[model samples]
Target chain A: DTAVSQTPKYLVTQMGNDKSIKCEQNLGHDTMYWYKQDSKKFLKIMFSYNNKELIINETVPNRFSPKSPDKAHLNLHINSLELGDSAVYFCAIGWGNTIYFGEGSWLTVV
Target chain B: GESVGLHLPTLSVQEGDNSIINCAYSNSASDYFIWYKQESGKGPQFIIDIRSNMDKRQGQRVTVLLNKTVKHLSLQIAATQPGDSAVYFCAALRAGNNRKLIWGLGTSLAVNP
Candidate 1:
């Protein structure tokens, strides 16, 4: 069973288009996170939800929003996707001191 | 801004040799540290972790060492194989930061046979 999974393994869209990436975790973890990995392989945290409550919100732009319907699912919605938004997005679930990440979703905005 | 960074961007090693990846963090408040391995087209995988209270922790073939005084961390791999070639990242979590992991830019490990 895939502990953490995200839909749309690859996304390619033009600028100004809005798209959403859905994530789900079956690990029954209390905290879920969204991270962006740039071309340089630098991983940066964007948002984190603990039991469906917003906890960590990095300095990401307003156009990028994260919604967690429940502790098992967290989705990212990007509006007016710009060229800078092109990167790999990963969903992760944390328990205690360890975290498990899903196969990332590659997003490219032209 | 406080962040975790790696010293070398890339490292090449022989298949049967040992490998060590080093990382430094500017946040002295961080108490928990972890090392992750990421293969091509995949997410980062947890390898080993260490806390400020302890200097070293060992896994199957991996070891993590933390130096709180210097705010440094290192991951050591034994008998690295071709499958071990991947990008290794070090992350730190502050004491009161709700476990938000501050990540390092990753070191690419190339294991040559």
Candidate 2:
């Protein structure tokens, strides 16, 4: 079974459009994270939730918001997406020292 | 700002040959380090990891070497195969309340037969 899963493997929308990507992990981990991978293949942490509590929030703009209903689920909502919002978003669950990531959701804003 | 960066952006190796990817981190406080491999259309996969206390760690066919003095890390793959072609990234984690990892600009590895 897939330990971590995210919905909408691919998302394509026009500028100014809003969308949400949902993620879930069955690993029963206490901490979950949202990462953005740019075209240069640089992975950057956007947000992290430890047991549904916001722990890490990077310099990301307010247009992007992350919500974790529970420890098992974390979702990202982007408002008024822009061209720079296009990238691959990955959901990950961390326990101890290791982390497991989902397949990733590709977001493209035209 | 502290960040993890790679020395070479890309590396080409022949099948059955050894490959090495290097990374440099600016944060000396980072105690934990990990190497990840990412294939096309997929998330980064954990390859190997090392701590500041250890200088080298070996896995199935991969090895991770850490140099705390210079804050450098390297991942070496033996007998690289075509399936091993992917992007390799090095990440560092400091000992603190923040568990967020600082990632490096990945190095693209191409294994040619």
Candidate 3:
């Protein structure tokens, strides 16, 4: 019973390549979020979806797009990835005042 | 454009000792706060949270203290064990219509045996 899960625990691709990371939550939460943790361990909010509606879109670049097919799933798609995009992408589900995070997807662009 | 940050990036403590991690947030409108623990390869895990009305909240062996006047928050772990060694982050949620949480750069805790 994994509450929140993200696929492709590790992703390695060459520069200029495009990829996607899938996420799902079984917690039946109404809100989902995508966060990026850089090499310096700074966690930044990228996007958030509430009931499949885009709620928050931070200063994320246009290359990063988040799609929510339903209340239980939110996926991140990156176009023309760059070396600076290499970091850990985390998906989370919010429950009232608390948020549960996935294991995280590590993306490395060479 | 408020930022949440930590006083120290890393802290080391011996087993059975109490550990305190400090965080400073610039947003006065933040009404909710949470503490998360992240292990080496895992994402941050929820620990405890506090509301702006309350200055302190406790859960199990963890306690969260909030100082609204100075816009500071601290997470204190009692009798820290090796299992508690992880990176901890403090996040704040704005008070109004939106519920987006602003996260701070984490503090890595190392519990020495």
Candidate 4:
């Protein structure tokens, strides 16, 4: 069974388009995180939700919003995406002082 | 803000040789440290983690050494194989009430056959 999974392994869209990426974790971890990995492989935290409550909101622009319907799901919605937004988005879970990541959603904005 | 960084961006080693990847963290209040391995087109996988109370921890073939005084951490892989080739990252968690884990830039390890 997949512990953490993210949909749309690959996404390509034109500029100004809006899209959403879905994530789910079967580990039953209360805390879920969304991370962005740039082309240079630098990982940055975008948002985090604990028990469907917003906990950490980084300096990410308002164009990106994270919604957690429940403890098992966290989805990322991007509005009016730009070229610079193209990168790998990973959904992770933090539990018991450890963290696990999803396969990653590769987004490319043309 | 606290930051985790690596000494070398890339390291090349031969098969069967032991490999060491070093990381430096700026936060003195960090109480937990973790090492991750990320292969191409995959997410970062947990390898090992060490608490500030302990100096070292070992897994099957991996060992993580943490030096609190120097605020440095290193991961040692024994008899590295081709399958071990991947990017290694180090993350530090602050001691306070927060869930943010500062991650390092990453060190690419290439195991030559």
Best by TM-score: 4
Model 2, range B33-95, lDDT digits (tens) per residue?
999999999999988889889999999999999988898899999999999999999999764
Q: Which residues of candidate 1, in runs, are more than 4 Å off?
A: B95-97
By the TM-score metric, which is better: model 2 or model 4?
Answer: 4
Clashing pairs in 1: none
* Least accurate 10 contiguous residues by lDDT in model 2 chain B: B93-102
Model 4, which residues run further than 4 Å from truth?
Answer: B95-97
Q: Model 4 chain B — which ten-residue stretch has the worst lDDT?
A: B92-101
Compare the candidates by lDDT and give the number of the best one: 4
lDDT of 3 by residue, A25-57 (tens): 997888899989999988888998889999889
lDDT of 2 at A104: 99
RMSD of each: 1.3, 1.1, 1.4, 1.1
Candidate 2 scores a C-alpha RMSD against the true structure in Å of: 1.1
Interface RMSD of each: 1.7, 1.5, 1.8, 1.5
Q: Taking the candidates one at a time, how many backbone clashes does each contain?
A: 0, 0, 0, 0
Q: lDDT by residue for model 1 over A1-110, one digit each (tens)?
A: 98999999999999999999999998788889999999999888899888899899999999999999888999999999999999999999887776779999999999
Q: Residue B30 in candidate 1 has what lDDT? A: 70
Evaluate every candidate with DockQ and list the scores.
0.71, 0.72, 0.68, 0.70
Return the top candidate by DockQ. Answer: 2
| lDDT by candidate, in order shown | 0.91, 0.91, 0.90, 0.93
